[model samples]
Target: MLRNGQILFLCALALLTLGVLMVTSAGMQIDQASAEQPILVDGGLSPIAIMSGRTGMYAALAIGVMGAMAFVPQRLVERAIKPRPGRFYLMLGVGAAALLGLLLLVYLPGIAREKNFSSRWIEIPAPVFGTLSIQPSEIVKWSMLGLLAWCAVSAGDRLRLFWRGLVPMLIVLGLVCAVIMKEDLGTAVLIGAVGVIVLLAAGAKVWHIGVLAPAATPKPVVDRLNAAINKLLALPDVKTKLDRIGVVPMPETPAEFNKRIQE
Candidate 1:
């Protein structure tokens, strides 16, 4: 039987596999077209060549991330935040400062243009490395988790009082939400959900958990709606099953109807 941690790991692995498969499927046509083309170009290969290189780079990043996570000692993480009262406050302050720095970096002159109206990533120019990109929201999510966990553990006896324990958490959560909303609403929702989960695990009240639970589900629908709206806004041909909606002389097969619609 797998332990709880092992089960969670397997589930994450499965999800990662599914995501990669989806990406591959989406790129399949382009990948095939590229593969059929000549190998060399003036300075570099075609756009397909660049994409093939990126695919390998992405795979390497995934492997490196997993390897780092697997080898890193849990004790080192724990020690970094060392269960001390003042240190927790210090860490929270540091996290806040780092978040602020990211925000400023995203808005700065040259960097702001690179963001394309979405201030979620920072492009750093490096001499030898060309350019490096960082996502501030990802850092903020992890930081919020650690900070909330610290708050929960510290609140201990004080957790009995709703005001003392809950207030601090709410304040931190609001700050994080505000920052993330400026850049990416989707990331904000995800960070908020994770923060709430960490709070619940830290022994937050049942009512609090109930209040936060519903916030997680609607965002997925909102995201889908936004994507649809964007597609429509772009003035692309709107293709939908609705075009065939009950408009057959004799009832046509579903597959046949779909093929006909495409035609």
Candidate 2:
């Protein structure tokens, strides 16, 4: 039988697989709709075909990353970060610089617009590379996790202190969340959640975690709520929700209903 952790990992893997399949299906539909008639006639594939190829490439990359993590000497990882604390800081600095560069690229001229919004994507002249994009928020998530973990471990027994251990984490997490909130609220919430998990794992006091409860509750839930609100506000069904919320009554006249719907 698999251990509990292994079972949980497998379950997560299954969910990820299902999500990938759904994404691929959606991509295929989008590709089919956008394909050129000549390509369809000649049996050439569309964007989905290209995406499928890229998915394979990404899978290989994921495998390679996992292999490297698995085979990397534990002693080396420890020595690299532990013995030379400067190395950890260097890695953190490099990651932060990369994230800043990505953020700046989002505002740079000649970058292709995504959905009429500024998103950080490296634009190459070639058509095939035009769509290549990277979200700095994702890197921020991992960086925060790594930095928090390092802080916790490096603090050693001092991590037991509420101030010495938790304050720094709270500060770092706050800064990261602020940066992420500029363009990506969802990622900010996710990174904060992971940071909290790492803190709890690092032997944080229950009360310390409890102290964060009120603050934590809003981050993830509020982001989702805001997104849903924005979507609803953009839709014709918003009046229905408003009526449900006791803001207004349902209109009786067709014209009035249509007018309210347009609001």
Each model's TM-score, in the order given?
A: 0.54, 0.53
Error of 2 at 142 (Å): 2.7
Question: What lDDT tens digits, residue by residue, belong to model 1 across residues 1-263?
Answer: 99876687678767765665566555544323365674332234344544354444565467568757777798997786565654545555666666656666666776554446676777777664456677867777777777777766766655445565666666667787777777676556556656766776677764443222123557666556545544532331222221222211223333343355356
Give candidate 1 regions above 4 Å deviation. 1-52, 65-78, 114-116, 126-130, 160-163, 206-263
Compose the digit string of candidate 2's lDDT tens values, residues 1-263. Answer: 88775576567557655655665555542325544632233244445553455454454455567556756788987777772333434544554556555555656778644544736444545454335555556666676688778766766555567665566567657676667666765555556656767877888754454222233465667556555544634444545444443443222333333354346
Q: What is the C-alpha RMSD of each candidate to the true structure, in Å?
A: 14.5, 13.1
In model 2, state the lDDT of residue 30: 30
Instruction: Single out the weakest 10-residue window by summed lDDT for candidate 1.
Output: 240-249
- RMSD of model 1 against the true structure: 14.5
Output the TM-score of candidate 2.
Answer: 0.53
Backbone clashes in candidate 1 total 0
lDDT of 1: 0.58
